[model samples]
Target: MSFSLFRASVRRAATAPRAQLRSQLRIPLRKFSTPPPEAPVPTPKSNTTLYVGIGAVVAAAGVAFYSFSDSGSNAVKTGVQAAKVKANFVPTKEDYQKVYSRIAGIFDDAGDYDDGSYAPIILRLAWHSSGTYDKESKTGGSNYATMRFAPESQHGANAGLNVARDLMENIKKEFSWISYGDLWTLGGVAAVQEMNGPKIPWRPGRVDGVQTQATPDGRLPDASQGSDHLRKIFGRMGFNDQEIVALSGGHAVGRCHSNRSGFDGPWTFSPTTMTNDFFKLLFDEKWVWKKWNGPKQLEDKGTQSLMMLPTDYVLVQDKIFKKHARAYADDEALFFKDFAASCAKLFELGVPTEQWVSPEPWIMKNVDEK
Candidate 1:
């Protein structure tokens, strides 16, 4: 055969075999004895997707923080000012008159308490409680209501005060919000005003006390005692001679009962009304030593109705104190104004200066009027 023809013939043989193999493989065949090796399973890709997701979250947080910082400066918060005074805690003149009106209702008729009695004793209770205040340690003031306790209630000066406290319980129920200290003091003010005394400037904030808070015994004055003893006792409470005389003006309302103070009778003719009479009687009335079986007390020589305690005699005899007493007797307005101011100061003796919201006076209303 020719060389070109032979080469072409060899190529045809090889190509012919490839085509035949392709055609034979195209026919479907089930392997009975042996299965073809399974295609190699692809290995799992490393967890790149999870890491990408975490990165996106971190980027979002970073963006948020930057946004807050880039915002305008935060507004400065205003702070409260120190040494700032709020407002006055004191009530007005109308408040006092209101309280007086209520007390009047309690005794509208002439015969109110045991045929027009008991009011004077109630006034005495208030005076004794507040009168115990000492400015030195700021203790024993109306702030504590300590009289509700034992030693204080049993005090000789405070005798028969329970009657006043018990009587006040009804008024307390009517004015539940008022503190015992406020109620008692305000009661005195109201009693005096209702009885025709000067207006007393008052403030509330006296706390009520439990039975254990009563004051020590012998804190009060004895009616039989002289000027020296009176000064010592009242002085312990931080009272001046002027304050002593002014506070004694409280006697204008109440009387000495034979059963109570052991010396019997009222200081003034008009016991219910507040007056200069206490001073007037001290100077004008001829006080004679009483001829009595009980205790040594003075009786008015003229009427024989008015009474004088040993302490009362000191007013006329003591030069320093007598000045204030005499001045009060001479001038009605001066006594009224001085008495009102001093009484207000006496009631607030132990209260801290800082705690006082207002230094001004609070005129309380009559419970009945409210």
Candidate 2:
């Protein structure tokens, strides 16, 4: 306890191994503890364990620095970005509504296109894409969006649909996650709703399929064909007489082009709007063979400007078909109801039931709907 003794004790403590001093102080040693000199220095065998412990601590410190430090943040951010890339994208109804809004915005942007609205042709694209479904083979239809490929795109019935496909491609770019099948079918739904037509219930589930899945040509109805052909084409699609008459009312909007279907002219006076007019005009008009070089289409003797395809005329000529057509022509509300139901079925033709995002299809709201 004397000054000289205390000085000697302090010198010994300082000179002794720091581990021994720490033990005297009752301090706990961690995993990488240093032994007192009298315990014998660690051998090369033990040095391996000591070096591994030091390396592990250094590695843990480096990870913490990378996670928290500004300079190391870029690496951390890159890892997060990679994780995001790997995660699957699932779109909600709101997401699909944004896509619908974009499609609706473009419908009226057509400068000189038919009726000054892209709605008709866009609807046609949707129809032709889905109409290819043959229930027997279970091939084609909107499920694959095979119209994006060859052979099918060049099918006679699909002529001029390129305009619609190209227009929808812009939408696909904005919503890169949406499948082409969903995009084209949704495009059809948008066209109908925007043109003051019936609401088509829709949901997204179609995935793109390979080109080899495309249906054979002539699956779509030939405009020049008569009632039996109509029965055959639509009947193959699983439609009964009433569904056939209702679906044909889609002609109430779009026209036949000589350059496209080899028949030219609009089915109704208002080609831009959806109405019972197609059925009405078919009954009201005096349709005679057109005096044209292109094909055997009928022009109304009254106007000469408006025309009808043989297929359109047959809805009135065939007795069974005439009954349904008469009902649609007499009652606009009935036409709207039938068309909405049939078109919804048409759009969803080849899509598997399991692929549907919901058990019940969503009624996508129109742009004007609050």
Candidate 3:
């Protein structure tokens, strides 16, 4: 069985920036539902959200239009000028590749990061940044890199993600035309592929978020919950059982920090690399409730070193979730295919399909792939 890995060839020439398309079409969702008529007092902890500065030019149409509210009442909004943003120059695929290299290069260069690489945190930034989408209200998701501001920044689920954001911000300085939504998600794809994970199809068009556009906290999954909660949370984003398990494969990479999530330990031995190991170990190992002062979590009875959250444990306990979990453990190839498709959907949660510039999202070549 082959791992399907690729190393970068000498950098290749990228296509020129394409023409910008201006649409008179009004976005279906009313930008942001005008803040409720009886809005509460704007406290420091109230509606304010975040926007990390990343300039994005449309790769397809070439326009710099960001979806969501044009008004300041939005919970999470982009700071980019709503009017057409002129780039110092039009961005080409080469521009994006430079960004991919930079994201890949950070892992080798960062001396102060986890697992000797920035892969894990970068995935979290992509997940947390995009996980906020609520299909019901048509709010949240990666469209606006809303986690940069308040309330959302200090949210429990987003704890420690500032590290990932700070890292991405450094890249934003170099590529001013890429949106934070696109850049961070691309960083996620880079981290996964470089770490030997699947190739996730990523597209650009995310606008930067504004302070007022921030979504309320508590939207992310809580490790303390069970299968019902899993459905409730991911379900809100419109994810089903199969997609939920596939996304959880991400835990194959990155350990929980005692200081950050309060839960501790790696789910798989190779936390910096992606593998079916998360599922393999989930079935192969004997897990027992971790005896700890921190919080109620699971420890592998085989070796007390590895950990699983109450949430992860439920995947096997529940009948429906267990079925999918076992399928992944049995077949790495199946897991990879499903994980790629689910993740591609995960990143595009709140984005309107029509807004995407490319009819087929681009599969960016990995640093290893020529």
Report the Cα RMSD per candidate: 45.8, 31.2, 15.4
The TM-score obtained by model 3 is 0.78
Pitting candidate 1 against candidate 3, the one with the higher TM-score is: 3
Every candidate's lDDT? 0.56, 0.69, 0.67
Cα lDDT of model 1 by residue, 222-298, tens digit: 66777787788778877788878887766655566555556666666655456788899899889999988767778
Tens digits of lDDT, candidate 2, 231-345: 8888888988899889888877666665656666566666666778888988898989988798787888986876777777878888998999999989999999999999999
- lDDT score, candidate 2: 0.69
Shift in Å, residue 369, candidate 1 = 10
TM-score of every model versus the real structure: 0.68, 0.77, 0.78
- Model 1 alpha-carbon drift over 4 Å, by segment: 1-104, 108-118, 354-359, 364-370
Sort all candidates by TM-score, best to worst: 3, 2, 1
Greater TM-score among 2 and 3 belongs to 3
Expressed as tens digits, the lDDT of each residue in 1-370 for candidate 3 is: 0000010000101111101100111211111111112311222231111111222323322222233334443212233333223222334455566677778777655443554567777877888878888989999998877787788888878777777888888877666556778899889888888777888998765766555668998788888878888898889999999899988888887777667777777776666667898899889999999887988889888768777888888889999989999999999999999999998998887876655655567788876555
Cα-based lDDT at residue 109, candidate 2? 68
Candidate 2: residue 79 lDDT (0-100): 36
